[model samples]
Target: MAGVWRQELSSLQAGTQNSILIGIIIHSGNPKIFEPTNPRYGFGGERAVWSFTFRDSPDDFINVTVWGSTEYINSCFKSFQVGSVVEIINSKVLSRRPDDSRDMFVPTVTSPLQITVNEGNALIQFHDSEGRAHYQPLLKMPTKTMDSLRSLNYVLQNIEELRDQFIDLLVVVTFIGEVRDIISRDGRSFKCRTFEVADASTEKTISLQLWDNEWIRLSELWEPRKTVLFLADARVGYDNFKKKTIVSIARKTLITENPSVQQALDMRLAIRNRPELSPSDPYSLPSPKNITNVMTVQQITQKLNAGSTGTDERVQFFAILYASITELNLDSKDANLLLTKCALCKRMVQKDRDSCMNLDCPSGNGSREPYNLVTFNVKLNLKDDTGYLVGCRLIGKAAEQIFGCTATEFQTMKAEQRMELKWKFLLSKFDVRMQVLGPTASITRAIYNILHMSRFETAEDISFDDIIDPMRNH
Candidate 1:
């Protein structure tokens, strides 16, 4: 390392030799193993490869790729995570080609040249010397300037004009959905997670899908409403199933969470006054405009059974269920009907404690007090003429809206008052808006979440028999 001259990424040229480059890893991808096409290539064995994005300055970042044995690549991948400052010694610098297949997955960077590190010719290790702290802060700096950023409201308003185009966005994380395993038709499997983000310009939120394993793992650290993301070159497209424009992490996209930019600071300040939702409930209630889809009990069952994602139907749809609550479980003595969860970690907490005790949570790391949110986790049985759906969830804010009271208010009520409130829902037919999460490997039963519910009157002239008769006749 002594013989190598230190080189900044902006000064890196294709012919540079015996140079050292220092940067913080901003995006770490999962390691992949590939078999050599020819018998002479890689000695007919599988070779391991890993790729990541690193930056040393505000406007200078490059894609760094490592090629070696499976053990070597895996070890390197595990050794350094996204925020680690690394010193690369003697890495081969080469100009990026337009037709390079590896470029399809690598994020577009400010630097035109790419760093390639092989086992023998190059080395990448953690920077342990003085001034390494300077590189670490670069991890949160936006790759693109604020001038290029677009508001979520603008993108939504002009989605038709900008379809299939990529744009930079600065948004606050509003929701993070569950991570799921996906298997393609070709038998390859990977992980994906969907989350929603919003900006100050709009109250509407947009969902973005994370397909990279590294990003999916990193998203676990993102806190709803508190995390700010600066997504560079995020692809915008229309979701046919949901009938809305959506954002996704594309090959050209580089995400910097909690970016140290003025836009990020302003976006966080804009959202600071908004009331917080339960961390356990990431999916919000569908607006009246989106709750137009109508589905019967049998149709919902058929949709779950015909799902292509194994037993799970990963796509969520909102539908109107004109059913009555058969079971409310209000009179039961079970202790779990109401759940107390830590807002930061989203883990269940003891009913007696006000703070989170989860040792793994960052906010609960003894530096600050963790916030707790009391939520209703009651289950209800719903039924119509076609069939019955059991164990449907009525949780968090949605449950409070339907029950006409807060969890704290309900806690103070007597058993007689609780039964009276339960009867109000049980005896009356209601129009219900629900989100459906079909069964998966981890969850054996389909999850039905009642988003909104309102009582129906006989004078309204809507009848369940009238709705079912047409389907039965057809």
Candidate 2:
């Protein structure tokens, strides 16, 4: 007989028996059916694995994976959804070993422990009203203000920035184009929808995409310029064919109409003042128009020296990719040095014994699991015939694009590979555009944020200079 075992999720260990755990479900995956290879099992059977990120405290959650027979999945867990409290009794803990795989984007649990429900011995039950009442205070802790939500972090990021990294986002939309159904090469048809969104932090309009059922539902409510949409938990990733960033919704994403939050209302006002719709076509998002005031490297340096340019001004310019810097060659005194960021909040976090040390962070407070994400800052030197700018930073998506891989992938490369990559970028030339964040007492203190980077292409149809110069004239 299994001995009595009851412990908090934080104390769960392998080999525990007659265990009991209770927490709310955060994410669940579809069940799969498979045939057992052993001759003893003659027929095919089904099993499903679901992930539960539960917490007794409202501030944080501990992720638990539960896998069991189809009968248990359908009868006991099928009704479970995010926010549902569940009680799991009589399970075994199986510790997962560290994986050294290259795909960092794939979700990996840092917690070594996982619980398996023993078929006949385990029992699973949903909490009734009285049971749920105990958790109500924790659950009813005031919903975070929109400003405090994680989605606000990426709202200001431009399309180019969004494309450079794999990130989940929250965005507010001011305009939505009509929906269209498109056929794929496999002769299958799917619905595609495109929309335009803008935020107070940026003047440029961002294009957004939704598909199939999401499009069908959103299309009915979506209005051109009239409807304001608050989209949460959408993913931002690159589109290979289009060579740009795209935002798509996932199952857990929240879509709401007429966003009344202060931040959304402020962004809507910003959009109304400078209303411009990006090309509605899903495949086409044009590059930023070249302004006549495009400054040269000399002009930018002189302006920085004089402290004449407004900090808020987003200036466009052209410069050559003159050099690249590695961590080995970095000056010890550089203020904008690289540091690791929290995956959820993008805030600098200190690593504790195993997990991150930001007690206020949900990941930090919820579970003892180590952080799966860490990022480094990359710097490039820009120059022209007139002057040069040293240590120009390329962060997040820009840095990822420059390396031609994700930050996680770059971090895993060998020392020699990383050194070789530095030289490769040093050989390339490009037109660089950036926004000036004003100068401090020293020229080195001035900050420039990369807005876009394009290769120096010289083709028969249209040369890079030909396309850029004409736009400048307009």
Candidate 3:
């Protein structure tokens, strides 16, 4: 395995590698006899994928296999296209073909733990609408290519025009071969695996998944192995590659259009009016409906503790993490009695009073004053995005980032310090764009109402209804 790559041609398997390999990462102690791990990400195929037309293939075609872990893949999952070398471990799980002939060049392994992607070789170039070959300076990056894309620092430095945003208006591409197989969860659902897509540096074969509606409409655009101007929405897709994510266009979301000689004119107009565009639209702004108010620490804690009685359930959500489903593990009878005494911090609280008896709390026993008390539990489920379902305590000071002063400090402060901290927290939310990346799993009441309400959800809903009616009519 050591110093063996430069000497001879060889086949490899499960144990350590055998003959001298083609190339390896110099940083991993494997000498880089070939492509170095890039420093500027823009050089990778993603730039090409992003800069090119959604419907077109690169002028050339290259095929490859890749590897990596599920979590790592998911992190950059939205950025690469199929076949880009996004991983360093076997990521694709393959099924045997009916003919007993194994897939020759592409990366695939039924037993994922058994395969790994270390190096690759391919031929690819830029293509046009007629399926003819050509060369282009930039390429669109597929979701799969994200892993390696960040390494191409030199590419990005050179392309100052394509900074953080990925942009592509038009380009051409070709599929390498005949249709291989169809993949779908149910027989009615349809999807496909393509031969390969390529540009100058690399060519990648990828899988294209389609739902029933898309499959029926795909034929109008399936002029494979030929070049065509692709026009439409270009979003990232996931694939088997260890380092690259898959890039795809849906029949409805995006498309490949026929080209005419006027393509050059169209290209010029596009470049002149909007030279920076690639196959993608700019990152979009969220809908106004998504905007909402933030709640005070007292209100947030109260709602989280409100779930003990099912009849008074505070609210519902579109989705909760799989681990957050407390009902699944408990007997329905005991679960109903599962009063959430913890103050969103999972601390045992005293239901008869507003505070917890656990003087052991780092925050100290909460205020002796008659404050609100309620019961709720964490929604974290092992099936959620992180997969491990354990809810953590939500601290108010942490949510608002009260530098230097804790909630206890605020409660006992000499009015001015407490007032200053409150102003800072308020300003951070309204003026400084303080966004909580995560949904408040423990929250049930509208944050704004919490700062000024005696009654909780019941009253809040009525006000919300009133606010919504006029907007709906308008």
Candidate 4:
């Protein structure tokens, strides 16, 4: 006699009966058919069970099982797929429990509660008179404002406090490692991709798994140090192998790149303040010794424009400093600029931390006394009569040589005093010779590596006029 109860997926509980549910089908598994063994059990002759996942919010989802006659399931529900909006009437909720039977072939739903639909008692609607399936608009999905989003620090610290609950939460984290492909241990055809992600709130990193098609679509966009926001509703579980809290992506999970969030801005600043490279790293420029294979600024520009420059190509050239050092803000007073490295591995080691976890080193041991490395990562504008190169990163040995001191010494000088000195020293000079390496192929922007630097000898210096002229003799 009572009207049908309308409820959201999040409000549903075990033992609920005579309820009507409306949601978008986020996932649908293949139907499993069961045949009757005898006349006594052949009430419907043959029946089918279909598992479906529905969600009303980006972070909330419910697993449901639809049971009906084989013909009804095959003809009516076979066309249903992900993203289709459906309404179900007269469904009963049951507490989902881990099945101990090893005969189950598919992944069992582990939600605290699940909805079940039986023949004659349930009705399904997936289409309109136009014969087109209906879908819920993305704008209708529940979302939280930036201010309402929970901090990753709280989630990582209090994962145990919120485990096994049905509430949804959002975390802003950054991806910090490579995505690696994984195959099932059973040597079956199963495959997936896993990556390490972290947040500025803590140094701890977690493993994020992307299965099937999700991996194929998202893996290409993944890069180290990229910030991402994750909306999670599933239970937080501990990973025994990784020894960290593992966050699984469900049908309701939403991963996005929204850098406007305050948390993302803070993480980006922290990453930039601390350089990833060390002094002893091979990528860092070596001290300038011999200069050879010289080329003009015009020639270098032509090579880059023509896409003929190889990533490993090295060439020497002369250019005038176009911008003032002060304007570039190369002398920032941020303390994170001063970083320490492991003596053995040549990898970065936190100031307060004692050991290196780099798998490449034999002595992955942390040291109380880490070798301090000065970082000089800054862009300098260089120009000659023929062409100009902007945002050329002057780092390591080349930067030290030009700055006239190590990073430690430069840090001690007054910011104002140093700026004045650098201006006079650089402005007074015109013939600046530099050996630059080719830009990385992956990056679209023009960024060259400053391998070497020196002042040109007046006698050996070729005039810009001669360098720019096509017929000028060397």
Candidate 5:
């Protein structure tokens, strides 16, 4: 626990992390010594602590007073050599002489009780700008196992087939197991361990379950002496009881080594600084109650501002990086991988993929090919102001078909041409946000879309073959 004087004395100190300092040393030649005590430091009138600081270094070097019981010092204990380090806890600097009328020029230490001697410097290690305490990112990763998890998200999130096949994308996995957790056909409880993953794209805690075969091979390369988790891929699904999904990873997800810290840092920076992102206020993270389908972007923006900017940095602090689960929805690797413009090559390519689709792309493999494309729909909406916010929904070629664009036309497009295509799609969404069509048409679609009640858009009154799902976003 911090002492009661911690806060008050800290205000007089130069920084937020440490307390005030004082010294007792004096220069050999210049007898004049003065250190004025600010009124806030407890001395209301003329009082000061005198000491000759080692000013030769140009970097801050203090001359603090040697503090101890009176029995510890001599009659002229006031004089001491510079650079003599000493410890003084729960002490304050003040004017040495209050009653003296003349020689108002000189100042000296009032009372200092040295706690210890031969003291070295002390550094404050905590970053408390937010309500929570934070440390520098320099701490070596706590685990020794090297797992490879790159930020392929900027490129991977744009994966059309992978996105369509999986309900959610899970990236970055870690676990404590050193051996495989194998479950055989005979229902034997052999261990074939799996890596656990959590991310923002879905609220689900996903994992990559290695089969006995992959686990065996992985065990060979994985040094059993120390525990290390390698990042890998997995297919996710709920268990028989449907409590939570376990990822079936042996099939598709690769088993790789651990990612380096530089990779993580780069991935984090990429996601944080992604172009066309909403700069959410770090102080204002929303609660579950605050999230609603009916909530406008403006309202969300307002709620975010009103949210707690944590004290001691426990709450909100880093603008792009919120430590919360939702804030960490996307993986760092995902951010680095998803922004890729080359759908075919999967290279760290340009920002505009449509340009590649149109021109003779070095990495192009035609638009209709399985790994050839990735597209997103930009939903533009107006809140209090006109068209102030945009939401992103990923889509595929089928969505373009719904928009009446042919494959040939979409493939041969320049950057502006593709943006124009997206812009047109957003314009249509703008009409929807504005409720462009009058009451009847709007009611017809809204009734069908929300309640799944209308016959015009759905086969509500007609066929039993109607998809029971609310909507297929892609």
Candidate 6:
């Protein structure tokens, strides 16, 4: 440390020796083990290699690669994490080749040179001086300025022209999905997380992936509908599974959480009153063509019970059930049986409160007119010869299809009329097409969502004794 000269990443030169570099670690990749070989003699033992991105200033960041024995490389990785300021002494500084094949596998940084830290030749330690605080705020600064920012709308509308290219985006996160493991072609396993983000330009949200171990861990703190991101050099490509153009975090991409930009503030304000994502939203239900399976209620239960809990498994299947509705609570006076949520914020609106009562939503303000949504959230008991599926959801447009009226129209009917509508489906066999969500850590019980319903009347299946008079039962 005594003979090494301190240098900023921007001033790094090729073949620099005895130089100290100080910066905050921004992104870290998982350590990799590879067999090394020498052309003169033979193949050497397996060695570990690790790499990370760091920056000293907002405009100066570079990729640092470390090579050494597995023990040394793992020790360095455990010692530092993203946002930790560190000092590298005597690491070789080399100019990056324009045609280097490694460029496609590592993040593109602002520096023209890269740092190589080899064990026994260089030393890396956490910065201890008061000046380390200066690098902490750099983590939130956008790698690129607003002049180059592309809104979600712009990217989507121009996806054809931008396909297979990189673009910077400023978007607000709307959904944070669970992390899943994947194996690479090289037989290495890694963890990846997919999250959705949107901007003021459009209501549509796009998904981005996190492959780096550090970013995947850091994304756990990202709150849906609240965290803003400035994604630099995000790759635009086509997703064959989703059958749409998508953006992903590539090796050249860098993400700044809640970036210090005016557009980020505006994006947050624009989406403040938007509806939040919910579980098993009917709007995102699979098309009828995709729902080919027809499993019985007992078979569905068995499949759910057999599902493993090792990963975040969100198993979804569609089935057809010929069941009679035993319980429909439309005529019940219980307040919880019928509830309303604010159309804008998707929060439950109290009966006494005209608005959602969320301070962040503009409708909650007294002067502004409040808009409420009273969607059908009715639950019904479906019974078949096999078993009874209690508390199956018959909500939204699906409920409207059976009742032959909108939720608003149904609310205007009298108690007698609501009971009349309920009796039409009660104790009668109907063909119900539904989606079933298996039990997960968040929700213990299986969720049955009725997507479509229609009466089933056939000479063979019909029974005269099943028909009952509602007035006599009342």
Of the pair 2 and 5, which is ahead by TM-score? 2
- For 1-474, candidate 3 gives per-residue lDDT tens digits of 243332211223334332222211100100111232564532333211111111112222222233222333332223332222221222221333444433221222122122223222211122223312221211332212212232113322333443323222233333322222232212122333232222222222223333223222333344333443333333343334334444444322232233333542343343232211111111111111222333322323333345234343233211111112221211122232224233323355454555445564432355333222233221211221222223332223222232353444333456455445434322121211111222243643322111011112232223222222211211
lDDT of each prediction vs. the true structure? 0.78, 0.51, 0.27, 0.52, 0.29, 0.78
Per-residue lDDT of 385-419 in model 2, one digit per residue for the tens?
45567666666655566568776776567767776
Give candidate 4 misplaced runs (Cα > 4 Å).
Answer: 1-21, 26-50, 53-63, 68-82, 89-114, 119-123, 129-150, 153-191, 195-205, 211-229, 234-236, 240-474
Residue pairs clashing, model 2: 61-366
Model 3 residue-pair collision total: 87
In candidate 5, which residue ranges exceed 4 Å CA deviation? 1-204, 207-292, 306-340, 351-387, 390-408, 411-474
lDDT of 2: 0.51
Lowest summed lDDT window (length 10), candidate 1: 465-474
Better of 2 and 3 by TM-score: 2
Q: How does each model score on TM-score? A: 0.60, 0.40, 0.21, 0.35, 0.20, 0.60
- As a whole number from 0 to 100, the lDDT of residue 368 in candidate 4 is 29
Worst 10 residues of 2 by lDDT: 322-331
Q: What are the per-residue Cα lDDT tens digits for candidate 6 across 1-474?
A: 578899888778999889998999988888988777754424357788999998999889999999888889899988889889999999988889988988877887888888899998899999999999999999888887799888788888899899988888888877665565454323346787777788888878876678878888888888767799888889988888578777888877878889877778888888877865432322245323224355555666766666637345666656777778899888988566556876656688988889998886667765457767677888889887658898898876567767889888988999999899889889988778887877777777789998887777752364424533212311
Query: Which portions of model 2 show Cα errors greater than 4 Å?
Result: 1-5, 33-48, 69-77, 99-112, 118-121, 129-131, 134-164, 168-199, 203-236, 241-243, 248-474
